[model samples]
Target: MPAARGGRWGRLPERRARQLQRQMQAKEERIAELETENAVLHLRLAQRLRLAGTAGTRWREGLPQRTRSLLRLQQAAQRLRQDLRELRAASADLLGSCRDQQQDSLSRILAAVQSAQHHGALPSWRARALRLEQSLQELSARFHRERQRRRRLHNRLVELQGNIRVHCRIRPAMPAAAEPPDPVSHSSSASGDVAHAVDDETVLVRCSRPGHHAVHKTFHFERVYGPAEGQAAVFADVCPLLTSLLDGYNVCIMAYGQTGSGKTHTMLGPRPPGAAQADTGLIPRAAEELFRLLSEDPSERPRVEVSVVEVYNNDIFDLLAEDGCAERPGLRREVLTTREGRKAVSPLTCLPVGSAGELMELVGAGLRLRARRATSVHADSSRSHLVVTVTLTAAASRDGTPEPRSSPSPPQAPSCPSPSPPATGRRPRAPRRASSGSPGAPPESPARPAGQVRARLQLVDLAGSECAAASGARGPALREASFINRSLAALADVLGALAARRDHVPYRNSKLTHLLQDALGGDAKLLVIVCVSPHRQHVAETLQSLGFGARARQVERQGGRGRPAPRGPR
Candidate 1:
């Protein structure tokens, strides 16, 4: 019985061991399955992380390009989202890098789209960028064009600036009546009183107060035709300037008037040579005064140099020089500074004079060179402006006392020591003519010495500034009138600028203005002599002159030594 029981225990033990082995196999199979699943999951995660790192590297490499590519990808994803049904229905194989890669890229793209949509910039950003590019291109083009335009404008302005001085003198007008009588009473007196009034008027005129007409006469610079009687006065106010010239101040006296007025007579005198009556013009009177002053002061004898020039059609010509020399073509205008540091032109030719007879000869030579033409207003009217300048250079001591060197010095020595009349020195080649059929060229003259202290007394006789209708001009005369009017208008502009005190005045706009710039606003003392007719026909011209004078009184000048302006009138 013991042997049978031991056999049963052994069988039971074997059966239990078989059951335990089966249990161990099932646990091992479960463990193997978990390891395989973990391996597959790990492989997928590693692939995704590698792809993300690659994408990040690409993003940093070229941000603008990568951003554009990413934007395109986002657009594709958006299309997929919008047409999900079509994407799902399409069975054709889609080119996708990796399932994990697509999923990760799609997720990032979706987030960006959502953010862009929330910010309201997705649709308009592309349009805005395109517009910005176009605007940059346009701005670049405009910058180039404006730079070129400014260059051209600057060049043009520089070319127009020349050296000249211009001044406008208007004839003075009579004062207007302070108050007019009642219109009704004036009309009644004119129409109601006729023949009986005429006979009574003669008896009343002779029997009434003998000085009644004189008392009624009003002294005026302009003409007033009425029952009043007054003597015609000429240059009454300008006499002071004439006197000041002998007192050592450089003076410029100009007479301005219309044609058929007394301008020529006042400046040149109406009496012809060898006439029965001796009539003297302002020129003769001024010359006589200068002579008298020189004779009175024998100790302070001055050497006077005179130059006569005419500015015709904006061209300068010297009267004393030969006609061909004076009328040289293509001479450019240039400004020069005197020893006193005054700026003026160097084209004027000067000649020394010792007596009044020599001055008269010079004046006659200038008159012959002046431009004159016939108009309905006058048979022989001056068509150009005449400028007579007398320069007096004085050498004085430090205390303003006359020195021995003040007397006229001998002619200057030649710069080259008078080289022996071209022993082998060939003559200089002549300049080529501007065009065919031109006149013969004149001989070249010696250059004048520079850097001389000169005080100039100028007398200007201006041509008439008249309208075509008033002057009855035709053909060439009409053109001349137009030019004259245009120059006058330019003068008016200069005066207006001076009156207004504008910084950049337009003196360079016209030759006339350039020529008179110094006289009008320079160191010289200027006296404007306005000549007006005593006839009622000249009322308009007189009024115009008076207006010019009013503007002239406002001109301010740079004082000598760069000092402040004086307290009195310039």
Candidate 2:
């Protein structure tokens, strides 16, 4: 009896559903019938209207009958319309119930599926996801390793090529403003162009004599820039050295040439007013690049500081200094040697820079204070050798050590063969870099203090080497000229000693060479941009400049011999 009762109870809901379904079907059928009747009535009314229009008086005879017929049709339509509304309401209710039932069934299905997944399939899926995550982590680690390897290899390639790179730039002829000053007469035509860039690596100087045969001298360097090449072309060769600087290496880029030979133009771009934005020089571009690189690794917030100094009259003046002397605003500073043997200038002002704009503004301010004098060689000659040093210190990690992200261990410099014993006075050794265990292995370095991963980008615009007679000067200007010539000669002597691999390099022969001892004799990467005029009148000075650059290319820093410039066609 209990079984029978259970069966009846279960059948009750099925019976009710069947009854509701039957009622819904009946309502739909009734609504369809009403719609059909309404359509018939509409057609009949149209036909009657057409008859009325065709036979106006004739149609009036049966007007009463037609009116009665129309009333009956209207009443029928009204009743059918009421029935349609009722059926529609009933049908809507039935549809809502059906939807509720479907929704309940779907909920039950979903619950069952979820239960199955939670118990049986979830663990397997979770394990597979974990494996994928592990694989991704491994891939990321491998990628980092490969990236570090590539950096090492690239730096190695650069070192093998040459640490001291010499590039020759033949200044193109420009208007009178940019030309060398002629004290003789204003009637002379522009100086004839004698120096020509034969190719990317060769420069040919045509020295034509009045009566004797014309002589052509070919000079080679790591790179050569033609007059057609823009500033971008020159910076392209230099851009890579910035990477080296960031990777924990000291870099120096110096422009050496005669006055009015475009050294200042190349290093700092053209001075304001007339200069286009596109002609921006190396210093600003380098600052922008440094900030760009720092932006990429936002986690490592590095600090950059800039110090501007000018070597004037054999004295180093801190252009950024705040001395109260209106006559000589730049405060004089002296170079000191640390216990580590590195050359440093104490009490020198170092302004911290946040962005490229800030760096440029600071540099611009310092440039305004830099000493300049008008001479026969250039209208606005840089009387002093300007050195703008940008120092970047790596951010510290939580443990107070150098951050690994921004401060990777720099590759070890190539082992230089020490040919002879040290001289009585040896210059301080260059700051040591992290030594790599092997070529392919990651660099292994001792734990260094925070900010120890510091590198310097020294942009030097050397005072042009000039002949005292050619660059006419009276009292103080003549004295300045004498000092400039002496210092440049001292620089030449240092390079000659380095090229000859002599035990004693005369870095102390002049303050100019003393300040640049690390770049010239140590492991720092050095790039000399030898700027020369294309004019025939400056042939002697151009040759002298080229000879100095040639000597610079032969002096290798540290372990390896200097890479010779690629010889071009005669």
Candidate 3:
């Protein structure tokens, strides 16, 4: 029994040992699975770290390069602004230095003048010094005024950089009708047959003769021909208006004609030899007359101011201002408001002239500055219209009593044989413009006193309206002809409208209209001189001029101031 019990205990122990071995195998398998999962999580975490490092490197690399590029652009802009400021400062400094030098030169000249006055024989140094002083004084004054103006303009430029009103003048062209037949080629025999067959046919006059005919001979058309009539004849029609101007009206006299029609000759006499003269044009002539009338009357104190301007390609230029004084550079048109508020433009320049000599000088200077170019028609054809304005101011007796009358007679056409008498009447006065101001102020207004008579006399030498084929103007001249034709068409339209009494006139169509707005439509007395040549070759041009004159006469009649009727037969 003891041996059997011992065997049982041994069997139980073996079974227990087998159970412990199975439990160990299962624990080992579970530990292996946890180890595999831990390895995968470690691989994923390493990959994530690598991706973050690459993104950080890319961000770091791009930041400084972009920052540097931005810095460069900022630096360039700063430099450009700095350069402009420096240039403006340098210009101002240079002007100041010039003025200083001029003053020193003038002082030395004055010293020399004083010494020369006291000495019996002037030293060469003293004589030179005197002349130098006068020159320097004049130069200094000019520089000073220019500097002030420049400063003002600079300020204005800064203010108006992009705010200014810009305008362009485009001359309208007359739509061409069917070209007329060559008058010379129509044979009389052919005409007679055609006339008989048609019955209602119109016979056209052929002015052109063959080369064999004496009338067909060609003559050189001189651009600067001597005046068509004597000064007396030219002034005959203009005398009454001139008298009114002197009587205290702002008067403007304009010469309108085709190119090569003696506009310059009519306005300005033939150029004199070996002498620089300004008192040759109608402007100077009128100025001389005004002074003469003023000098003749002791009771009247007359003050005259003048402004000269030229309109080129619809651009306004101030001839009186310093050369290259463009307030807004590259602009074609500009407005000039007088201290009184009268506005004129298209490259306009205003100046004040106290005497006939000064006025003449100003006109001469303006002529020099005018846009002139040699063409087939004229040596120095004015490419644009020239406007010279004369403003006359008169003061009557302070007592307010009726002023003494030089001539009691009212305005009347002068009788021939007796020298043309001056105009006699109280000149019509106009309200002072809102733009004119005192002499000391900027000439922002163009208005003057109303009680004081004001007149504007305009002299317009219209560009010749020529066919492109006839003028042989190519390239630039062709362009110029186009512009000229447009301007003339506009003028013709204005005349037609005035003659027809249209309620709405298109005066704002072009620069020419704006420039001539007052003369054609304003209250001031207006005179137009239409010059014609009697040459048979110029018959077409002559006919055109006569037609224009006739139209103008019609306008005058409509306006209640037509030409006086012819007197009864002698």
**Alpha carbon lDDT of each predicted model:** 0.53, 0.75, 0.52
For candidate 2, lDDT tens digit of each residue in 1-570? 999999999999999999999999999999999999999999999999898887897787889999999999999999999999999999999999999999999999999989878777877878988999999999977976885676677678778768999999998877765565544334332446789999989999986756546768999998999988888888888888887776667789999999888999999999763477668888888888888987876645655777888888887766655444433234566677755466767655565667898888878877776778888777788888899988766655556534533333343323232233321111212222222211111011122343345667889999988888888876877888888889999999999999999999888878889888877887678899999988777888999999999999998766423321111110
What is candidate 3's CA lDDT for residue 477?
69
Clash statistics: count for each candidate: 13, 2, 52
Quote model 3's TM-score: 0.49
- TM-score to true structure, per model: 0.49, 0.66, 0.49
Clashing pairs in 2: 415-559, 416-559
Arranged by lDDT with the best first, the candidates are 2, 1, 3
How do the residues 121-157 of candidate 3 rate in per-residue lDDT, one tens digit apiece? 5576678889999999999779758855654454344
Model 2: lowest-lDDT 10 consecutive positions: 436-445
Of candidates 3 and 1, the better by lDDT: 1
Candidate 3 has an lDDT of 0.52
Candidate 3 lDDT score at position 429: 19
Off by over 4 Å in 3: 1-206, 210-228, 272-281, 324-343, 346-349, 395-453, 557-570
